[model samples]
Target chain A: MPTDVIMPALGMAQESGKILRWLKSEGDAVEQGAPIMEIETDKVTVEIEAPASGTLAGLRVPEGADVPVGGVVAVILAPGEKTPPETPAGVEPMVTAQVPPPVQRTSGRGRAGRRPLASPKARRLAAERGVDVAALAGSGPHGAVLATDVESTGRGRDGSTAGVPRTPPRLGAIWQRMAERTTQSWQTAPHFYLSREVDAGRLEAWRASTRKRAGYERVTHTDLLVKLVAAALSEHPHVNAQWHEGGIVAAEEVNVGIAVAVDDGLVVPVVHAADRLELREVTARREELVEAARTGTLRPQDVGGGTFTISNLGMYGVDAFSAVLNGPQAAILAVGRIAERVVAIDGHPEVRSMSIFTVSFDHRVVDGARGARFLGTLADLVEEPAGLVP
Target chain B: MSSPSAVAAQPGTRELTLSQAVNEALAEEMRRDASVFIVGEDVAEAGTPFKVLSGLVEEFGPERVIDSPISEAGISGIGLGAAMTGMRPVVDIMFGDFMTLVMDQLVNQAAKIHYMSGGRLKAPLTIRTTLGATRRSAAQHSQSLHALVAHVPGVKVVLPATPYDAKGLFKAAIREDNPVVVFEDKMMFAVKGPVPEEEYVLPLGVADVKREGEDVTLVATSSMVYVALDAAEQLAADGVSVEIVDPRTLVPLDRETIVASARKTGRAIVIDEGHRSYGVGAELAALIAEDAFYDLDAPVRRMCAMDVPIPFSPVLEDLTVPTADTVAAEARRLVGKE
Candidate 1:
């Protein structure tokens, strides 16, 4: 029997993987475990290996085709073995059994018979609400009708007026996944935000001194924060825990995910066991992850097993912002830009570098008191980072 | 048995498995009417494989809860003859796959008796059968053939999804003047649900809104009812509110309720365990399209079993029928979420 080469599932929640390219051509003799194709999932792109040592035949799916997880992309047949007449086992036969010819567009009556692809509900709502569906562009696949399209008829996202329909711009894979994850977090995870403004004088000095060292020239405040957050998280295991199926599960390893903004959207790549890694190691790992994220070549391990996330918008010069929790994770720490501020020190006006740190916690996992204590620990570490940063 | 008023006032207080509910309904009916009796192969003691009629023989004795030969046709013919002569016989066909054998007595004879005899003759017979696959019974034992009997006019078809509906609908079937075929999902016999202790009868051809929502209407029957409900729950997490309408009865299907739900939601997906082509789903989809076409936002979709025979392998059998995930995916597509 021919061995079916299926689209491997790399991520836990991945449904499909897009084929990047076939490493080997059809009828090529290949050894088992040899990389045959490159497939990209929502999380990362990885090379798929040949299941058996055979001549690869029946390459069913083409390059760039997004086949579902476990779906057959090709078959590996023994030498002189013919391609079977029936579909390979585990493949949906119904999907391959029939192929209807594409409909050709005709003029006059044929053209008049063709209607805009809108859902039945959308059409009904449009009629009930006295909205012209034809005038509204759909956001659904192939411009099909959507209930939202009918409800929001005559109003575009940019507040454009009626008569001019606007098709919503398509989102890339990362951006779409980000949207779905954020929406899910917002809807399901009850979030509670705790904000604290800490003196960044010691943190800045630590970063500056660390940058002066050889091979640590790129040490950043975010990297310093990752180290500090990891230390504080080790002390506060409750904050490092995740909300899993209505219970708090303390993650054994404090894998801190750094939110990196790529061209497409936000991608969080984890720095595994940040608490154990040195400041320079954290910086090096962050750089590698950010680079991989930007190039869309992040491995599955780079994005998975994140117990907590740190999103630093300080580079953008933003004063302060609270982020949504990266769901399942108990908390996410958002860092703001460090700026000079005058404060009364011992009843005298003194200048200090101040930065606002906001931590968003999943209320189900971490309570207000626990979150405050964690934030207090983080603030203390930020104020006087003597032994922690070194 | 508790009084009808007591149970009716606080229905669904008591929980019972579908098996227990059906057994209770039979015992209640036989006690209420002396003319009512049970006839099937091994139903007297063995309870017909699923043990749905266990202990019924002790309550009504062997004469009333009689066991018959393995011939489905013979038992069905006997039930039809007894019904015509004034007995309300509840004929038990062990598996719905065997319903094909009783077609002559059920469809040709029982279904056409009243009409052919100019309303002078009536067959107050109820055939309790089972439908649904994934039982590893292979093609011969596992088949959802309710659509076959439902196609005939004189006969009525009711599928009970819950224990409450199972008991109530079974009682109503016995009281029905015309021939009624009750197709129960054999796998659901052990499924427990809230059933009132009091005596009650659910009217035929009435649809039950198992769960109410607005985004889309899932018109599921029998085994598919639970599938649709599971899908609805999943879709709810995605922010798509799905309305589940279970048309407990198929023949005199409650077109009004089904159509109204489709109109209200503007989308409908009919789910059935029968084969996709010419199945209950196709008929429901057609009815919704014909009645609620203008109100619909998407074309009516049908999620039914594959046309192939139910495979014997557990892995292969699972693929032959619609599941919660598949139903949810289809619902998501209709609502424009996918």
Candidate 2:
């Protein structure tokens, strides 16, 4: 018997997976459990192994084809088995024709027998919208009337009701997911923002001295804030909780996620148990996570199980900005650029390095007073860097 | 209608193979009711070649789980006679193709006992059988004959696709007053799914929407439910959304759910493992067309096995049935996506 190599379901809601490339070609002898192809899902790219040890035959879909989950992309035949005459019945060919064959209809029929070939939905919509189905040209198979045709009639060109020419931009999977998540968070989560400005004199000093060290040369302000935020979260567990299924559930670990921008969109890779790690270890993990995010090679563990998140746009020269909550998580800390400011101290002018920190909280989980206290603690730690780093 | 997540969301749910689930349902029901007993061929020690009744003989003893000879008609008659009395007898037919031999006892005797008696006497019998093809069991053993019994008036038929449905529907079948026949896909005995630990039963004559969609409705049964689901996923990539409705029970079929889905989608395709002519698909397509005619965009289509015997050759057998590709292609054509 031959074994089918199917496109496995990698996620709960994933519809299809794109085949990146095949490691082995048709008629190649392969061993079971060996990596045969790489597939990219919405979240990660993973290697698919050969289901059976045999000669790989009957390669159905080619690389770059987005095969549906559980669709047979190839087959593995036994050593003495022969390939079937045709592609197996259920295996979908990726490049089928978009248009269907013409239907054979009798001509010379009157309006009584020759009713308009409109779908039931199309007819209903046409009646509702007061559009004539006979005057519209359909793009559906066999040129049958469709709902879109009815909707576009008496409208602007190409179905644009705004009377303006427009073309929708195609987005990658990552960007599409980001758009959906941000919109969902904004609409669903009741957000409340708290902004605080703290003197960044000690934070800048900590980064400078740490960068001068032998192994800490690449440490940035984001790494320092991750360390301080993890400490503050350990003290105030309420802000580290998530709003899940209409209740507040506290996370067990203080895993902090850092938002990093990539070529396509943004990714939040987490650093597990940040409070328990030393500053050097935290710096090393942060650098590794950022590099992985940029290269699109972050593993599953690097992107999941985050209790709190931090998004810092300070490096882009922005003063301050509030961010949407990275949801289920109750709060997110947004950091702005650090600049020199003149302030009155004891009736005299003094120049100090200052940075703004804004925290967005899901009001369902964290109230005003709890969110204010958490930001106050984070600001205090940013001003005084005594034993918090160690 | 139970969604896919409802079973898993239950507390203390555990994964069990379809065989294990059936066995557990039988054991629980036998323990609950003293009058309940199972009778079939090789049921005691052999466990009917699938080991579904492995521990039942030991737990309930051979007297209750009686093993009879290789006689379908004789055992069916005995089960009918026992059911006509006060006892609740469960008759296990090994292969659905052998339903031909026991047709007189099941159709003529068991199905008509209560009705012929004018509700004075009752026949509470549950006939469990296996249905499905492509097992290479040759023409004698591989056949989906649920449509045959469903054609009759008094016999109730059910086809369970998943382990969760199998256990729940089987228990419900045993408790019903009328004669209910359960057709389990022979190829799906090893398939695993979540079954709740708590006691529960799924009422007959209810349908489940396995996957919800907007474009086309694919009404599938038994093994074909998985096929339709696979095709639905593939169609989703081509921008066609396919919804799948599993009619768990054939007789007293859930017409409202199937018609509502067809009315919403405006297109429907019925897929079954039985023969294409006068099969389950024909009945469902006729019902949907009758109820949702104006709501339909295209004629209701039927996808079933070719009107021929199940071939012995693997090559020919693969071509006789409707697969995911065929279903997807048919859906694409119906929704004008092709």
Task: Give per-residue CA lDDT, model 1, range A172-289, as digits (tens).
Answer: 6688778889999999999989999999999888888888889899998888899999999999999999877767889999999999998988999999999999888998999999
Q: Compared with the true structure, what per-residue lDDT tens digits does model 1 show for residues B6-123?
A: 1232444687888999999999999999999999999988978899999999988999989998999999999999999999999999999999999999888999999999999999
Candidate 2 lDDT tens digits, B213-330? 9999999999888888889878989999888999999987999999999998889999999999998999999999999987887889999989999999989988899899999999
lDDT score for residue A377 of model 2: 93
Model 1, TM vs. native: 0.53
- The CAPRI category of model 2 is acceptable
lDDT of every predicted structure (CA atoms): 0.85, 0.84
Off by over 4 Å in 2: A1-113, A154-390, B1-10
> What C-alpha lDDT, on a 0 to 100 scale, does residue B108 get in candidate 1?
89
Off by over 4 Å in 1: A1-115, A119-132, A154-390, B1-12
Residue pairs in collision within model 1 = A118-A145, A119-B297, A119-B298, A120-B296, A120-B297, A120-B298, A121-B296, A121-B297, A121-B298
Clashes of each: 9, 1
iRMS of each prediction in angstroms?
A: 2.6, 1.9
